[model samples]
Target: MTSRPLSILDVRSAGPAGRALCVEETAVFQHPLLEDPPASAASAEDRRRYAILQRRAEQTCLACPLLAGCLYDAVVRHDVAGYVGGTTARERARIRTLLGITVEPENLDTLAGVIGGNRPVDHDEVVRLRAAHPDESLERLAHRLGCSLSTVKRHLRRDRNGGRTREQEPRSRPSVRAVLATARTVLDPARGSRRAA
Candidate 1:
């Protein structure tokens, strides 16, 4: 019942077009320029250097086929570090604020479940664990079930909702394309300059 968090695997599953340029150009994305900008008191030379690198990173992202998916995941699902999807972490926070969305920090314990090559936890197992330990914390329940916290949550939510999946639940949320468009607005030079002024 728990879907895996959006990852490079999800990106690659989209086929050849999903092969992210960032994966191929790992060093480029890891450069200091792709990270947060220099401090305000940084020398002009450092700032200038950052600008050059930023542009290069942006260009690389722009050329990527997975830009939309990457941007959507970065903004909505994961609080990633460094430059990704043509936006900085700060920009992503702004986008989330503007869209009135929040992403929960994933539990570190669940990371192993994400890529640990473990078998998917069954819904019945989650329910049984909860029944057996009615007073236990959800985190504890997850630990007992050997699954991610999100997976535990999902299964519980489904059980509470008469086994309806998340997709079956009616909720209003922006589309990936809408999020991508909002990112463009967030990264707009004119808007940024206005904010600076």
Candidate 2:
């Protein structure tokens, strides 16, 4: 699909105007949908307030005349998170699943282009990781990628800390039998008979 510019009006418009249906606000920024749920990381009081706002926002969105259009946009965009035109992550995931669309939000830029979402990770993070670790190790790279060492190395061709190149393969393990045999020979040398005068 072709990318299009996101308009503030598209986000802020409220209520019906003409044949296009009223602007959707509640669905676009449903307070309840935006609030961390009761089982979230917020304080108890904050959670209570969030629940209240969420309820009101849900009510407003439900009554909005542009609900259909908002739903269409939210579903088609494969938005995995946030209150897009009124749908939550759960709602969006369900819509995508029903439509046979993959629901992963790995490519945040693509999602943002379609659903007006923010990038999950940015290049600055990569630059910072590189700067902080001038001798970058695989472990550090993995942490930055939020993936396993192998996965990080696969994508990142160079180490940020300068420890090793990402393309460096694992060295083969030493032969255990060879090591044991060498150790035995070193520990037990043949003794020559000494002449007693």
Candidate 3:
């Protein structure tokens, strides 16, 4: 059987699906899908801006044409880091939940440079641990892992990149933004409505 093609907007339009994408999109912004940031930016505002960038990236993914392919690749490979097809670490978890798989496919090798020879944690696991231990600090965990504090914090941060705490629990259902996006499309398939707007 052939799998249905997914849209970046579709990933974000489905309440549960979109929120999951938001989590991964948040990671891509904090750590970047490309390169890691310099160690000097330990300030609070700098981190805040980095989060903003992640949310913007999710928005970008929502608008991209290849989002379906990206999501497929991410799912097949079990990617545990960065944004793909507008989905976040949390979003991927939802996918896993849907598929009923437990193993992860995203390589931890992408973290080689960021952790300075330390084996870094994957984004999905980080989300789980953060959820499991809401009182813990990502920085403290990184210290124990012998990696940069930012790297740890980046994993814990939500995909939305809003001012919310990294440890906040996710909604059991789709978010309002996601429902609106789908509803708008259903109402009028001609004109476009931004998902994260």
Candidate 4:
């Protein structure tokens, strides 16, 4: 059976909270300000608009029942885009850095077709590619597969472990509440500067 690539909607719907506010209200949540940080030379008006949009998006996220789950997934599981869990991509990156955590970068090209790429590389495909090119490094495989090195490793590891996915294993990462608390500390200017000092 041919399986279609999972879209953001598919993933969101599969979660316990049904669908996210961002998915329903794309205009406010998926604005460029939330998806990508403003350029360094952005005008004052642009900066003002970004701040407003950020606040709006954050409010929307804060109202969602899935905020914690969404935030944890974005910060700890997938390098997703747009405003998620009341934070921008850059903010999530900062939180990950402060937490000393790194997530596998999503194959955005596969997801959006922005770079003319196709669907995600499945486990079977990864195994076939590895068998076809026994001598190729994991990095090369990742490049050819349009995925991250960690994704390649994950697939291989899952195959070796008899199909037990990461979710089935014990997690060593911090809880969502802990991550949120850390985010507040890191993003608050007063607290952040005090901690840095």
TM-score of each: 0.53, 0.38, 0.38, 0.56
Model 4 residue 19 CA deviation in Å: 3.8
Off by over 4 Å in 1: 1-16, 107-173, 189-197
Clashing pairs in 3: 15-174, 20-91, 21-87, 21-88, 22-159, 23-88, 23-159, 24-88, 24-89, 78-106
Cα-based lDDT at residue 52, candidate 1: 77
TM-score of 2: 0.38
Expressed as tens digits, the lDDT of each residue in 20-117 for candidate 4 is 77777788775656555566677788788887887778667765767768877888887666677766776787888788776655545455664345
Q: In candidate 3, which residue ranges exceed 4 Å CA deviation?
A: 1-7, 10-28, 31-54, 105-140, 148-197
| Cα shift from native, residue 178, model 4 (Å) | 2.7
Best to worst by TM-score, what's the order? 4, 1, 3, 2
Q: Lowest summed lDDT over 10 consecutive residues: which window, candidate 1? A: 1-10
Candidate 1 vs candidate 4: the lDDT winner is: 4
Q: Please give the distance, in angstroms, between residue 153's alpha carbon in candidate 2 and its true position after superposition.
A: 23
Q: Could you give candidate 1's per-residue lDDT for residues 113-188 as a string of tens digits?
A: 5626656677888888888997666767877776665577667756886876533211456777568556645666
